[model samples]
Target: MKEINREVEAILRDMIEQRVRAMISGEATSNDLLGILLETNIRESQEGGIKNAMTTEDVIDECKLFYIAGHETTTVSLTWALILLSMHPEWQERAREEVLNLFGASKPDYDGLSQLKIVTMIMHEVMRLYPPVNFTERSAAAEVKLGEVTYPPGVHFLLPHIFLHRNPETWGPNANEFNPERFAQGVAKASVHGAFLPFSGGPRVCIGQNFAMLEAKLCLARILQHFRFELSPAYAHAPYTLVTMQPQFGAQIIIRRC
Candidate 1:
């Protein structure tokens, strides 16, 4: 945990340093997303314990959270999405077609991303099969009953997303299959309330879900528009859960200019 925190700190420091340099060099005059986050962090620090707050240290800590939450989560999602697309050519083709239809011969933007229903479906399916945060734990504050099972206070429940996602009863017969069409009508039509939660549910739901999805849509649209991708001959399909679910053997794909 210390190592992880240190790594996050380093990344955050680097990002801030880069932005500072850009400002100094006149490469960037106006504040961007990072600047907004820094300002928010300063305000939070002042509210907490700092007197005349808004220190550089406070900004660095906030940037660290962004680096860990924003960068890590999005990278895991994109990696899994690419792997799933490579493994399933038909789905990839459908996604490409949908992207092209929505923003043909043009650059992808926020409005164009909102129109990518098929791509969104494909992304949802990919996240379902290979959720970044595969498992989470919750401790009961009081005695609780779940159907026939009863748990005493202080009991811990493990929610394994990978297992729940593959449940045959909840999903159809081919629950393990990579079928994006299952989400054609959205998640409400795909599974029950607690059945599908890649970004989790309720109050603790991911704060950057919208940002992540938009980033993914833009990246995918740009990649598909410029290149056709396929699984490499030597590619291996082995997924394992660490901090996030990632390909154990790295993602190898054949990319051809479109």
Candidate 2:
């Protein structure tokens, strides 16, 4: 296990080094996040000033963060949304109907995607029920007080996304059920007390929230445009968590061309 960990770490380091060097030396041109970050670092270093840009190490750290926080979480959320949609054909049909009405068997434009009301509702509900990360942690810098509970200084707090999202008190009676209608009004008004925290909330919210949303929307749109999916007979209804919550068995969904 230790050897495997060291091997993985070395591979990550090598990849980061090669990527950064490519951007710095003008050997690779990509429009992806890594390329943009590398470009920024290179430009800033040339312009001169520590305050102007992140260091190489800082850029590498951002790359690592992007891998851990951006890629897996985004993919997991998308997978969960698809699985949920497959299980609930009513929602799937409605989403597909919405997709067809706007895009109509053609490529979905960004403008049209932004107007997908039903799709947005379905996405939000899925996020609420199956947030990519099950839990997150934060340590108090100082004593904090909110309502009846007071947390002492340096106290580590665990915020369980699954519990908060599914609790009856937080989201009312149907919290455990899959109902996208709850978010029909909008996210800000979905939970009056602000219990919804899929990508988390506040200043330290997920950095790639917008990116993930856009990607998921586009992916869902494309899939619905030509395919209707449902759970296959072989599919087991077991969900478990590793780093991110995923199907304990693989998601075995049947796809039919629309």
What local distance difference test score does each model get? Answer: 0.82, 0.85
lDDT of 1 by residue, 157-234 (tens): 889998889999999789999999899888898987579878888888889888888998898889888788888888
220-256, model 2: which lDDT tens digit per residue? 9999999989988898877788988888898888889
Judged by lDDT, which candidate is best? 2
Ten contiguous residues with the weakest lDDT in model 2: 55-64
Per-prediction TM-score: 0.81, 0.87
lDDT of 2: 0.85
Cα error, residue 115 of model 2, in Å, equals 0.5
Model 2, residue pairs in steric clash:
none
Q: What's the C-alpha lDDT at position 39 in model 2?
A: 77
Stretches off by above 4 angstroms in model 2 are: 1-5, 19-29, 45-57, 142-154
